[model samples]
Target: MPRTKPGVGKGVLHPGAGVGKFEVRRFHPDPDLAPFVEHLWTVRWDLGDAPPFVQRTLPDPAVHIVFERDRSEIVGVVRGRFERVLVGAGRVFSAKLHPGGLAWLGAEDASRLTNRRVAVDALFAGVDVAAREAAILGAASEEAMAVELQAFLRSVAPRASAEAARA
Candidate 1:
């Protein structure tokens, strides 16, 4: 089900702007990916002729990989609050990795990536960034995007140590 309750610092853009203008949906990860992933989330917006909406949020410990029409990046745990302006119509597909899941991606110190945005190819050597991005953005629905993302993640599943696994 979609996240109805407003998360920390969310859903306050232009208070009482009327419903149905924005939607945030979350989906469970495939069973095999549950160990390293929390879930996938998609944010869709259509502000129509209204002014742009500025959404803000406090950072969490989990790492996130955000995919958009023009770019995709592996966003490490942010150290401070950040804001994004939602203008026009667009959708963002994000994968929220579990706490300590960065280790699975070969990051020994997740803190090092804090406040940093790394290109996907910089981490996943064999991934075809363009193709993957196309598959994700071209998906007809959030569910379809989740399936594509899950498949891609499985194909590049990382190896984590026993200690990391326990963490």
Candidate 2:
């Protein structure tokens, strides 16, 4: 599986690409968690008085746990391009799960989630959605947010099965 992103204009189709105040930051996964998680990344943007920016990307076959200011979700594989509109100033922190780690700590089959988007509660039980989301998104810095995300994952993530590793 491709753990690294397709560079530049390929998978990334954002205007000005890596230029401007919009920034994408990726933090390495915890050493022990590396087998299941590819990375924890955050996108921060500040447009001040400028027009909203449109960013698009060719998503890979994987699951993503996205945490925004107001909502958190688990998104399955996207067979198409992903697009988002950026306005004002905001940041989003997310964890990209490997294909071999799809089951997470749940018994649900990863195949059942193809092209679907579900609430984080659907996958993680006994989690305080508001509290966790607040702890991560409300963090003062991206590093702090990444740390919170890793802690959250460590609390619930599962070990990859041998068979699942080859999927």
- Best by the TM-score measure: 2
C-alpha lDDT values of all predictions: 0.73, 0.76
Tens digit of lDDT per residue, candidate 1, span 1-167? 22222341243344354346677777888656678888888888999888987776677777887888767878998888777888889888888899876676665467778888888777778778889889987888778889887777766655634433564
Error of 2 at 84 (Å): 0.6
Best candidate, lDDT-wise?
2
The regions of model 1 sitting more than 4 angstroms off are 1-19, 160-167
Provide the global lDDT of candidate 1 against the true structure. Answer: 0.73
Clashes of 1: 0
CA lDDT for candidate 2: 0.76
lDDT of 2 by residue, 83-142 (tens): 888889988889888875666555478777888888887788878888999999988777
